[model samples]
Target chain A: MIGGKGISIWFFIGSLLLLYGIIITIANVVEMVSPSVDKQPVLHELNFGVWWGILLLIIGSVYFFSFRPWKKK
Target chain B: MLGNLKPLLTPLMASSSSLLSLGWVDSLIIIIYFAFVLGIGYYLLRFTKTGEDFFMAGRDMTMWIAGLSFVAANLGSLELMGWAASAYQYGILATHWYWIGAIPAMLFLGIIMMPFYYISKTHSVPGYLKLRFGEGASMLSATSFGFMTVFMSGINMYSMAIVMKVVLGWDIHFSIWVSSITVLVYVVLGGLLSAIFNEVLQFMLIWLGALMIPIIGLIETGGWSGMVARIQQNFPGGDYTHLWRTMGSFQDNPMGIHWTGIVFGLGAIISFAYWTTDFLVVQRVLTAKDLRSAKMAPIIGAGFKMMVPFIVILPGLLGLAVVMPKLVPENMVSAANPHSYNEVLPLMLARYAGPGLLGLGVTALIAGFMSGMAGNVSAFATVWTYDIYRPIHVKLTKKEESDSYYVKIGRWCTVLGVLVSIGTAYMVQQFASIMDYVQALFSFFLAPLFGTVILGMLWKRATKAGGFWGLFAGMFSSVGMWAWVKLDPSALKIIALSEYAKDMAENMYRGLWCFLIVVIVTVVVSLFTEPKPEKELVGLVRGCTELPSEGHLPIWRRPIFWASIVLTVFIVLNILFW
Candidate 1:
């Protein structure tokens, strides 16, 4: 039942990859900004919380506008 | 020739009393556990009515059972024992793994990934690949999964053998044979049903073992506060302090592990790939009675994961702080050395635990080992029978084949899987730590496959060519990066990097970078390629619309949508402050 054209599949795969890359980049950049002092122990090395939050926000917004759960044929 | 025989014979000679010293009670407990496992296998034989029954337990598993089994399957003896040992050497940084790496990743999978996966209703994770991409991607993913299974089997066997050698004084060869035979017998007799039921029992024993050690340690050293103070006195620099404080160093500082490595390097990728994509975990979910149960299983498993560090890792810290000082430095050194960290948990048990309780600890240890082994065997058999065999050789009306025929093949596959695993286990013995070896091998295959699979599922524009090429590119890049780090640690150094950053860059698995490259290349290629048909993409992404409505959400929004937002904030705040 589930099938797709070659180009759409490529786009989908590319976007997901890009999203992961962006998330990792953001996490790395945040780590650079909040560099830990030599004397104090580093509490958070990578801020996955922040990036994961952003991801949820994006996913949520897309779902909110596009979703039509109760729509009938 | 005589000298060669003596080297082997010496270990055998030493094993007798070591086995005997296990005490009659301990021996009886082990025997009983073995019998219980075999009994489950035999009892479940009747249910092996069809291939589906054997491979998936006829998809009748309840949420709680599936969830608990998921936890049990993942909590191999090596995991607990290795974690405890890490705590002994490094400190509380070990626990940070759960907070940063496991919990969030699991939650992500449960809410985001599972809905997509469940909608597809494929039997194996790779089967979804065939649907989304093509036969090439599916075949590649399945092959990688097979390789991983073989790798894991070897590591599990090797670790179990090490535990026996250290705790029970069995020789390496004897231990290997015993562990292999024990797993092989039951797996060959039953199938997933036996594996799951036995996992329930093993989970209980492992929990008992994990809980008992710390309780006994606390009792032995007086009480909670008394034990803490003693640990403080023994290990300076407050290494015995709270868990979060320990992420600074990799060496003697128990808590000073590089937090990035704990969360991102190992945690995010490994947990996400394994829980969301790997057959070992997915098989458990697929057997769930319905979608609700499948969704609930990983969530429950995550909750259980939060409790693990306290039970397993803390005691190892206690052992290092309070118990090991009594041991000679040479003995402790020999035991705690990186190459020998596997001995940490066993030595702690042998030295500290009292006689009657010692038997229970040993039983629990074996339970953990066997649970992992059985999970792997069953999963491998499922993949072989369902994904490979059924697709290639056996194509009939689903109802035509007698249930017994499917069941018979399931049992045969179990034997074949175990035999292959045993051979791999022997090879894995060359590695220093079983965990490291398994993780390293997994990263190579997992990251690239993950890139392609995520692309195919979520992105409508992704081409099969992109998916295929992206996977290869990711794999090659990851492997190349890994080789560079290993062969020349200083080659890829970036200026002004934090000590933790430097460590991550230096020791980071190349496979992760490979994954990144694959993703990048795949995206670039897809951008230039022609788009796929919308009709084909619809069901692949949006899922079946005709099914009876229960808890279905539109592809875009659900309550978990908001919850993920709020929880992410909470996790961040907690990490920052703590």
Candidate 2:
């Protein structure tokens, strides 16, 4: 049991954010991988999708890993 | 008008669109969703053995569950559908409700107010007022809150029905009754616990259900910049993309609300009152097992809340840029009906999502209404039982009843609450601008309630007489102002700079004046009226109470730290959109 009040929840939320970022970044990569999508006029603007993902990832990772799940306080 | 995305409309933009086009798969998805909601309620019934279990979820809710439910209860048909419509009509400016209007105040509540609330062990917001200002204030807040909750529930019901009627061509009465009865069952059976649980579930579904619009719309438009370029090309000088630019002057903005009204009237007073004091959301936090969880709930909720505009508000902007222009002619005239934009959310759902996804999308809409209605009904029941009914019962009978007796009454109140909400939903059909009226209710109920509670909590000298009279004065002033504006447009013109300052029609300015009346009256009356003894006020008053130390937690995990991050994001978003 994580003893801290908000520790575990932060980890969970952070991980979710990181996961969201990874997924979107991965999707963009996949679309970019496709020659057809790349050739299309769309700039594949990852503006909000990528940036928000990165922000969430940072916030989520910092919290998620703040306390080692395996360590005892 | 969604220029580049026009091709994405394809089959969806076909002349005929209805629920039948959603197919059997969609219907099954919706059916399974409802069954799951009701099934959980019935399943949770045995756990609800006591009034505590029913009303406060036995006060054992964790930070995540409580936090998610806190945000979820705030979202509903109104947030999803109404704001989507507002986004359609008002543009990116509508995002104010999600960002500036919400984030700062929610952080304030989490950092400042939650300690007092959690420590008090109060069953409801009115119960808190009762401790500080005495029972008269309690009863007034309770009765007004009780009415507000039911009416709010009805508005949710009405909103969903209208969306369905416009989109799927369903019978409004059928939709309203269906949602009302479902909410009545789940809430009555499992009470607050069920409501909270469903709220969390509804929260996830809403995201899964609605995220497609911005996703598909963004992709089709080649991304945010592309969409912006298209919108600029299509609606040049329309004030659609810029957030603060239009707020320079009332006439500059499409919505016509100036920066002062948005900031002071809405961002401070209205937002703080709703996020901090409204029991419907506050009750969720109070149910947390401990103070830490309670404080964490709203902060976590603020995180989620900051993201909501991307889902709800963008659809509205997309509607204006894409769907509305496609659905109507370029020369189409504006009407008073917000539902015209309200349909934008549903259109986005229909346009992008299909088959199983469509079912999920539609279910998301239903979930929003049911979750919203259940939230209101459950809140009404708690306030009615603890604040209104129980006190009256004890006074009349000169006795305290069994926990079971009160529980029974709560259950009965739940039923009555649902019925009243359903009735209110029927009444809502008469109004053209439903969301405006719903927002107006805050001026009438919350402005005064907030006045009393904020004064009572912060200032120990706020006497019972002051609290009661302040509440009365605040509500009276608000209603009188509303009436004055309605009966005599000249009065509104006199108050505002221009006939078209757009401030006159806004509930924000009205709430501001009402809030000012509440504050002035509350302070004046508090000065004159005799205050209660200091001994009587302990934990209820700030500085008199000992707040728990959270120093052990690191800065990253601290509420203030997260609050700063959220505030930073808020500033960045405003600047980016400006």
Best by TM-score: 2
Q: Alpha-carbon error at B539 in model 1, in Å?
A: 5.0
| Shift in Å, residue B303, candidate 1 | 1.0
Q: Residue B359's C-alpha lDDT in candidate 1?
A: 53
What docking class should model 1 receive?
incorrect
Chain A TM-scores of each predicted structure, in the order given, are 0.37, 0.56
Q: How close is candidate 2 to the true structure, as a TM-score?
A: 0.84
Give DockQ: model 1.
0.01
Error of 1 at B139 (Å): 0.9
Query: Model 2's CAPRI class?
Result: incorrect
* Best DockQ among the predictions, by candidate number: 2
lDDT of 2 by residue, A1-73 (tens): 1113322334443444455445544444444455332123222343333443355457547766774465466
Q: Lowest-lDDT window of 10 residues in candidate 1 chain B?
A: B494-503
TM-score of chain B of each: 0.84, 0.92
Clashing pairs in 2: A11-A64, A14-A60, B88-B316
TM-score per candidate, in order? 0.75, 0.84
lDDT agreement with native, every candidate: 0.63, 0.75
